[model samples]
Target chain A: MGPPWWQAKFRGCGYRITIAREVILNTLAKTEDHLSAEDIYNHIHTKHPNIGLTTIYRTLDVLTNLGLVYRFDFGDKRARYELAEGPKGAHHHHHLVCTGCNRVVDYTDFIDAEVRLLQEIEQVLSKKYGFKITNHLIQFYGLCSRCQADG
Target chain B: MGPPWWQAKFRGCGYRITIAREVILNTLAKTEDHLSAEDIYNHIHTKHPNIGLTTIYRTLDVLTNLGLVYRFDFGDKRARYELAEGPKGAHHHHHLVCTGCNRVVDYTDFIDAEVRLLQEIEQVLSKKYGFKITNHLIQFYGLCSRCQADG
Candidate 1:
């Protein structure tokens, strides 16, 4: 309906949409799964072998700074990213990361009770600690089904 | 109470208790705040100048493996550690990290609703994804009072 997200996000900014950056953004947009820089690089490399890994990493940082992407650590050593311009509710979903097999499941099924609980928690934290809450991250660590079966 | 946590943690295991390991554990036990590897090294370096940074790193790996310590990343690009032997509820508490000044508030005022939410999420995830749930981490990122004031 309106302007596409990438344009809207950087219209005011001087960030020129390079081919590499465009490929990275498009790759993330199409994926429903969280991906590390290496993962993105590998995917982009298949289509655009000329795109360097460093370019992907740099573009990812720019996207994260521009708020077009979300970067998080799932207790995994590497940082993972997802497109923040996706569907509204999709951006706030939490993660279920399997510690054994390193499987990540994006869980967005926030019940009414959970929403109320988060609101209460944010209220309490903001009042008690004088923090102006902006964002939150939650991840559950465990074993995936295949790993559980193996274990 | 029962042979001390460090001793019990390595009781049956072939891990011998070294002076360096004890210092590492004792240092973690003393601090309620998360300490990075460099932070821990600095604290112990003053008292035990002989203890090398490599020793601290190795000891941290051992402690983390034994579940005697907790390791997490606060999007700060450094791994942070905290003692796992804190109060029952203390271990399960979440973190409120200030993006402005990087202050971390360890919030433990969890009610039954939060626990229930987690259980529900875990059950649903485990059922749908065949995950064997074990643990979880939650953190809220925002501006602290000082940062809010500065802004």
Candidate 2:
């Protein structure tokens, strides 16, 4: 299909659509699941060898700033990027990441409950500590079926 | 007066009691707050200027491996670390993090409900997709009072 909702969000965020951005966006869109910046760089490098690691980092930064992409740290040294603009927004989904094989699956069904709870937490924190909460991420780590079976 | 549950957990998990680990653990223990590695490193480094950034990273990795510390990625470059063990256990509490100032508050009232729901999710993921989830992290992010006031 076309670019995912997150790609469109980048545009909505007033980001200038450039070759590097498009390449990075397309790479993320096509991935079956989350990919690290290094993964993206290596994939794009084979075809567009001119692409620099700095450019990938910069584009990912822009996408994250625009709330168009989500960055996950599944204990990996490098952050992984995934399109945040699915049918639900970035905050709507949680991740189930396989530590054995490094696979990621998005769980979006609990958006309403999660959002409500988060709002309540925000209220409590603000009232008690006068701190403003913005966004958060939840991730579960475990083994995928194949890995579990292998183990 | 003593280490938080998580710090005790690290000791129980066979983690070495090194100066770096102790400094890091002490920092987290003293706070009812969540802090990024950089925050912990900076705070500790002030007292021990020779500690390297890599040591912070390594100490965090060890703590996480032992399930003594929890890592949070609130759309920030550096991940935040907090003591995970509570009166109940490491998995009993969820975190409320302030997006404005990066302050964290721990909440433990929802354990029963979360445990039930998480069991169901685990079953679904395991049955349908063959994913075995061992642990999960839930954090809610929002604007704290200071951010709200400044805004």
Candidate 3:
């Protein structure tokens, strides 16, 4: 319908849009779940044979640094990435990951209270430990019904 | 003084206590915060040179599997480990990490309402997605006062 969600984000963040960047962004845009860098790289490589794994890594890093994407780990060896530009635009959210099938479902309903608590904890830790807190991630791991059924 | 907290846990769980396991457990026990595998390896190596990195990996896996330790990612490249045998034990507590120095502070106090809400979210996700929810991890990140002062 309209320009894809990530395109608008790249524009808003003043990120230069290139074919490779577009491909990567589009890949993440279509995914409702988290994708490993390798997953994104393999998918893009099929359509754009010239795209290097390094390019995928670089693009992902740039997007993460720009706060247009979120990075996560679910006890898997590799890290995963997801578009941070939500349906509402520039929103923050957490995830519930089904350990059975590795599906990630986003939840933004509790963000305000979550953020407030996070800030309070950060304050307490800073005062108590002399440690600097930068960013954080919260993930819930469990089984989806399909997996639960099998189990 | 007395046996470190984890020593009791190993005995309580009926896990075989090995030399390397004790070193790993005690290393984590002596710390007041989280430590990466390499951190534990380095500290243990000074006293136990024959302790292979592979053993550290193996020991960590065993500890995690037995619920003797907890594993988490603090946006760090390496996985961090902490003793799970705390005042709140494994499942009931969350984490506070200082982004400044990579210190992890345990927070056992939790609002019951928040816990209930999380369980509700878990149930909803389980039903809607066919996923089974096992456990969750929540960490708050910010600058500790020492880092704030240094900055």
Candidate 4:
């Protein structure tokens, strides 16, 4: 209840917890869908018409750089974002993007086999390339059920 | 060798095999590095000064749409491209990107364990979301050894 964890992070990074940033973060935090800047603007425009699209874009950049948000490009030319740490805690997952309909599914079921594979891959890559591996992104592209049915 | 396989694909898609396209494809095909449109233009500019950057950009869009190239976003804002099919055949691989230097290494050692894990994940995701999975992309981000040493 005390200002939330991310506000402290914002202060720690020399960034003031501005209202625009707060609203943008809250908008992303509420949605399971990966939303474009325009989408975020649309979500809050009615209630907070003072917030401009440019401000949302700039704030999203700040949040992403602060590791408070994750940005993604699903081959759509535009970037989409979601809260990096969701209400479910550190909701780490990858994406399943529908090429047909641009629907995105967050695949959160990181099973044991996945853990082992990533461990092995990181080990091999670190040894081979001398990389200090930190993070990874995986996205699968195909048709969602509704799109397939339409086709 | 006879006009290469991709030319036929272009023709099959009703796209003419233009020289600018050929040069762009050749430039990407020859390199292991993911080249931005500017990088491709830079590589071919001295020899083919007439082929402007606009042509390069336009051709890249066509090639990307035709599925003759794969486009990637390494969080660098610029899109990088590589040939879909290489001289060594379909060179399917993931990337390990150095956040410090923007270095990209193709991780091609797809072991049996990795393959099995992907199959399992695809199957599980397909059942859960009813998605007909097609292709995937994986990218790991971190500091390369040089960057770590420099730090």
Clashes of each: 1, 13, 23, 0
Q: Give candidate 1 regions above 4 Å deviation.
A: A1-3, A85-92, B86-92
Q: How well is each residue in A1-151 modelled by candidate 4, as lDDT tens digits?
A: 6767787788888898888888888888788788999999999999999999999999998988888788888878899988886456545778899999788888887555576688789988999999999887778888999999999
How well docked is model 4, in DockQ terms?
A: 0.72
TM-score result, candidate 3: 0.75
Quote the positional error of residue B124 for candidate 2 in Å: 2.6
Candidate 1 vs candidate 3, DockQ winner:
1
lDDT tens digits, residue span B46-137, model 4: 99999999998899989888877888888788989988875565456788999998989887876556667787788889889999998777
Give the interface RMSD values of the models in order. Answer: 1.3, 2.4, 2.8, 1.4
**What residue pairs are clashing in model 1?**
A145-B130
Between prediction 1 and prediction 4, the one with superior lDDT is 4
Worst 10 residues of 3 chain B by lDDT: B108-117
lDDT of 3 by residue, B33-141 (tens): 6788888989999889989889899999989877778887866667888787575444456776666666566666554544766777677666665556777777777
lDDT of 3 at B69: 82
Cα lDDT for residue B68, candidate 1? 79
Best by DockQ: 1
lDDT of 1 by residue, A45-134 (tens): 878999998898899889988878889887667889988855552556678888876878877776555667888899999999889998
Model 2 / residue B80 / CA error / Å? 4.4
* Number of the top-ranking candidate, with lDDT as the measure: 4
Tens digit of per-residue lDDT, candidate 2, span B1-151: 5654455655666765778878887788777656887888788887999888899999888877777677766555667777766565344577676666665666665556666666766767666666877887777677766667777
**Each candidate's root-mean-square deviation in Å?**
2.6, 5.1, 4.5, 2.7
